[model samples]
Target: METNHINQSPIDLESLISGLKTEDARNLKLMLNIQSMMWGIAAVYVFISALKFIMTTSWYDKLGGFLTLVAFVAFALLFRSYYKEYKTIDYGIPTIEMLKKAAIRYELFQWRGLYVLAPLLLEGIGLNLMMFDDFTNLEPLNRILFFQISYFFVMVIAFLVGYIIWKKRQKPLRDYALALLKEFQS
Candidate 1:
């Protein structure tokens, strides 16, 4: 009786490293595209606000200014958070690689939620405030306060949704990372 043997080769470390580098490059490109899209949205917002200011001479402009400032602050915070997370992953500290990946995923979810929620919240506030101009019976202060409250509620909901998504996505990644670490150690 004759038996045939099949030979399998192990994965090459250099090839693994090259593959990782390519993935990193792709991630960097994706991050750049996300950033560009964010900036483009911001630019459009600024242009629209500038047009509103040029055309209107009302207290609505004050509300617009406040909303714009809020947007800028939120964007700055989100961008900074994203940059920090990106740096953590890009630096590749082997000890914390899994943690960094987890952080990146969380940050991405948070930023995405904020990106969707911010404009919705802003539009809600803007519309509510605009109604005040036409509704002479409503006090300006009351309208502003109502808009703020509504905005806060929307933000809370957005964060909750993001957190739920993050929690769901995190489990598999955590398990995979733990398994990888265990295998490496053994």
Candidate 2:
């Protein structure tokens, strides 16, 4: 009878305290860790390529490579900060505090995103400058259609992928955190 009464209770204490036990939170941590490692590897590769470009005889290559390095370094640092934020999640913290952290962490767009635009613009400009020599021999129209149009398509694809990831993964985790917070408050 006691067991049956307990089962009929309105709230389950176990469910409330299991912060990281939720599937969404666990998945979020795993995804962040994996992405952080992958971005670190990509940063290293870009560093090597940038060095090669800077070592070339072409003046354009040198300038473009320097710009690209600056932009990519910013991206790498941003990704590292995200990784560090997730790493700081401590189970021992108060549940409300932990949930608040998770909510902020999963936000799809934050002020930092605005700051990223400068680096993104720099990268685009740098890439175009780097390709100047290659595109020089092509007809002007062909160069625009081939290089510029293709770059636009690549950016679009990347944006769509990022949106999908946020919607499918990050948004749900955020929603979950909010829901848990609401439950706690009531």
Each candidate's TM vs. the true structure? 0.54, 0.63
Candidate 1 scores a C-alpha RMSD against the true structure in Å of 8.1
Q: Candidate 2's residue-wise lDDT over 20-116, tens digit each?
A: 3786688778777777776776678677767776578887677777787788777777766766776667989999998998898789888877877
RMSD of candidate 2 to the true fold?
7.6
Clashing pairs in 1: none
Identify the runs in model 2 with alpha carbons over 4 angstroms from their true place: 1-58, 138-146
lDDT of each: 0.66, 0.79
Error of 1 at 145 (Å): 4.8
Model 2 poorest 10 in a row by lDDT:
13-22
Q: Please, what are the lDDT tens digits per residue for candidate 1 over residues 1-186?
A: 122221232556667889999998997897778777777777777777677767778767657555754656576666757576646654456755765466446443444655856755665666665555765676868777776787778878987886787668865676666666667677
Question: What is candidate 2's local distance difference test score?
Answer: 0.79
